[model samples]
Target: MKIRISWQGKEVEIESGSPGAVLVEAFGWKDPRPIAIRLGGELLDLHSPLNREGEVEPVFPEDPEALPVLRHTAAHVLAQAVKELFPEARLGIGPATEEGFYYDFEVPRPFTEEDLEAIEKKMKQIVKRCYPLRREELSKEEAERLFSERGETYKVELIREIPEDRVSVYRQGDFVDLCRGPHLPHTGMVKAFKLLSVAGAYWRGDERNPQLQRIYGTAFFDKEALKAYLERLEEAKRRDHRKLGRELELFSIEEEVGPGLILWHPKGAIVRKEIEDFWREEHLRRGYQLVYTPHIALRDLWKVSGHLDFYAENMFAPMEIDERAYQLKPMNCPFHILIYKSRKRSYREFPIRYCELGTVYRYERSGVLHGLLRVRGFTQDDAHIFCREDQLEEEIFRVLDLVVYFLSVFGFEEYQIYLSTRPEKYVGSEEIWEKAEGALAAALEKKGLSYEIDPGEGVFYGPKIDLKIRDVLGRFWQCSTIQVDFNIPERFDLSYIGPDNRPHRPIMIHRALLGSLERFFGVLIEHYAGAFPVWLAPVQAVVLTVADRHLPFAEEVQRELSRAGIRAELDARGERLGFKIREAQVKKIPYMVIIGDKEVEGRRLTVRTRKGENLELGLEEFCARVRREIAEKIVF
Candidate 1:
């Protein structure tokens, strides 16, 4: 028999056998880098046999689609090493993540640092052995029997869930795993890898299920790439918000209060206030009416908004109050909808925007909660716009512009925007969904912005435009979202008198410029490394005296700054000027006004910036310069 292989618009006839044969003849055998074959759009093992003609493409190491495959192979290698080290270890699921891979195991005890070291050593040995990975297809009954004999209860359970009678499994040396895989030819292909850390994870992310030990690891195509990744990881550790939150005395999460609830310190609260004041002023200037709502509302309100049915999992349990059930608000949409319904509106009032810094509560899993990013209670910079159908596109354009402005002001110049369409189980009609999606796309195009379509990732109620800001370290944070909702308006019976003098449904747009103040603050902390710009800094300037005699002079300078609306402080401690300067630096203060005998006598201020720039100027000159820098929100 003959088989034809077509690649890059070229075709060749070869004797029927494995695709690996053609690749070896065309390229070479056992190349060091990750190289695989994609047959008719399905990724396949290079050794996968081909008995018929098909279009083939080579997946190189640099291809974006190849990293998941490489990481998955590394996961298999990790499992093999674990089984070798501890023969009694049983496996759970191992999957590839965005950054790397992780494998769960049901071991006698949690893995220790020493155990990870041993497992990594054994993985290296397996790579040296270059054991070939072979795939096998077996009937469900046979697969269950195979795993049962090996005491792999997890594998047996997994097999039972497979609908198809035939299941695929991969084996290397004495290790076997139930998987539908397109792995590398052998273990040697994984050139550079590292075992990062281990943590306890409930099976399948359910709190009711038994917890398993999960080992996280990463792999790269070469050693230098791996080295670069490790260095970035180190820098990330140095910028970790949790560490800096404490070291800089910004915020804290205390067990006495509760998990996922942040206790903002004085300095942190000052920063938050600055952000809130700026946000409110900008919204007011842009035609938004600020409003306030209660933290808890009657449960029927949620039912009307569809949150009770669709979002109950993330909501707190209901509290019964005087024969009525009340729930902590998980969102501000319902209240805003109620506000619109309070009075009959007119088309002339179209594009009515209501914004609030509303605090909301949700029940987050304890294990998944971080310091401030994944908090249970957070204040959202929430807004909702009610507009006519014809105004939808223009309103979206305005929201996108506002989102970009807010992110840019916070020093986020690079971002990734995604337009998410309707999901499978959605509330609105298909016609409305298509219209909303088209409006979002049109707005993006009108603004000359490029965005990717995230199919089936939108909320059940609406389509949305999600903006992810890339910080200084090249990490992305989901901060801003603009969603077009038709369901809530219909559910709430929100209507406006149109030009025809008839009541028509007003489409609602839900927006959050900063998704949550706590999360955004955490991102800001890490993004700027706690060295906030002067406008956002809690203490913009600190006055320090060179000697006890200059205390009066330092106090006067600080008072003048405070009068000028700058957040200034006076460090009047009985320590040396260098010690005081170091303390101010540690606090990440933007400016330091040093007063020595010469400056005190001359009635001048010596200004030192956080970046170590110094300038000797008259008091008035220094204040003017500082005000300009703060007003401009300069980075450094």
Candidate 2:
């Protein structure tokens, strides 16, 4: 049969055979970079026959889609190498991840560092052999028989669960794996690869299943790219929030306190207070009514909010309070909704905005908890806007404006925004969904901001807009979310008197500018490497005396800065000036005010910034400069 395919902006017709044959004819069999083909928007194996005519695009190493394909193939190769090294090893599923690939194996024992080294050597040998990968389709009975004969119980179990009678398997050398693959032509194509680490994982991610040894690895097409990635990984390790948190004495997660619960130290508490103070003032200035809510409420509240039905997994067990069940608040939305229902409102009071730095508790798996980023208890900078239908779009516009302003204030200027649409299970009607989605889209367009549509990824109650802020290391953290909910107001029977004096449903918009203060602080720690700006720093400046005689002057300097409202500390620990300055730098204090004999005699302060820029100025002048920096929230 003949097929029309698009290649390099040109369409051509050719007599089709195998996809590999067609592609080789178009872009040469010797072209090493084109490893796969995209047809009908699905990545396909080159060896598969072109049974139908369709538009096709070549998958190159540099393309975004190529990384997963490359990593998937690398995973297969890893499995192959493991089987070769240990003939009795049984394979579980192997999949590609955003950063790399990992494969789980049911081995006799957990893999060790030496085992990883040996596996790496075997993988290199496999790559050098240049074994061509081949695909084979089989009936379910045949696949079952093949895996059963090889004693591959996991493979047999997988094949038995296939709904369809047909299954596909790929083979390279003497190794075979059940997969739907578009792997590279030969093993040698994976030029640069590294086995990252080994960890234990349960099959299918279930604790009830047999545990398997999971080996993590990454592959790049070129050596330089691999080197750069490794360097980035090292830098990320150095900037890890948990490490910085301990070193800076910012926060802690204690076993005695319980996992996933953060204990904010004095320094960390100061930073959090600053963030909350800023949040409260800005919200008040922007016409938001600051309100407070209880940490736990009657279970009936959550049931009405649909948390019991839809989000029970993330919710903590209910408490029997006075013989009535009460649940720890997993969300602040229901509480905010109750506040709106407490008052009778008119259209003139439309767009009634209520905000809270509300602390919430959710049950998170211990294994998933990571420092403050993933925690059971966190305070959300949450707000809800109850408005008329006509005010929906304007409210959303305002929310987006606030999101940008909030993120930018923390030195996060780069962001990716997504408009998430209705999911399969939703509470609202099609008309409401359409209107809410349209309103969100209009707000984005009105602001001249571009966003991608995340199809069917919205919360069950409504469509939403999610904002992910990219940090200094180019890592994206999901921080802001603006959801348009028509269901909750209807569920709560919320109403406002219109101009016609009729009771109408007020649209509820749930938004969080900084998702959770705990997670946001974690991101900030890593983004700035714990060297917060002058405004956000726990200790903005340190006063260090050069000698015992200089203590009075240093204390005086500290008093002046404290009087000027700077978070300054005086280091009169009888330590050497150089040692004290080094300690201040280690704590990431933004400025160090030096008090020595010369500076005291001159009535001047010798200031050294964290970046090592030195300046000589009067104590008052230095204090004024710092005040301006803090007032302006200068990043440096």
Q: What is the TM-score of each candidate against the true structure?
A: 0.96, 0.96
Give the Cα error of residue 336 in candidate 2, in Å.
0.8
Give Cα-based local distance difference scores for all models. Answer: 0.89, 0.89
Can you tell me which runs of candidate 1 are displaced by over 4 Å?
1-4, 12-22, 26-34, 49-53
Per-residue lDDT tens digits for candidate 1, residues 499-530, read 89998998999999889999999999999889
Residue 519 CA displacement from its true place in model 1, Å: 0.9
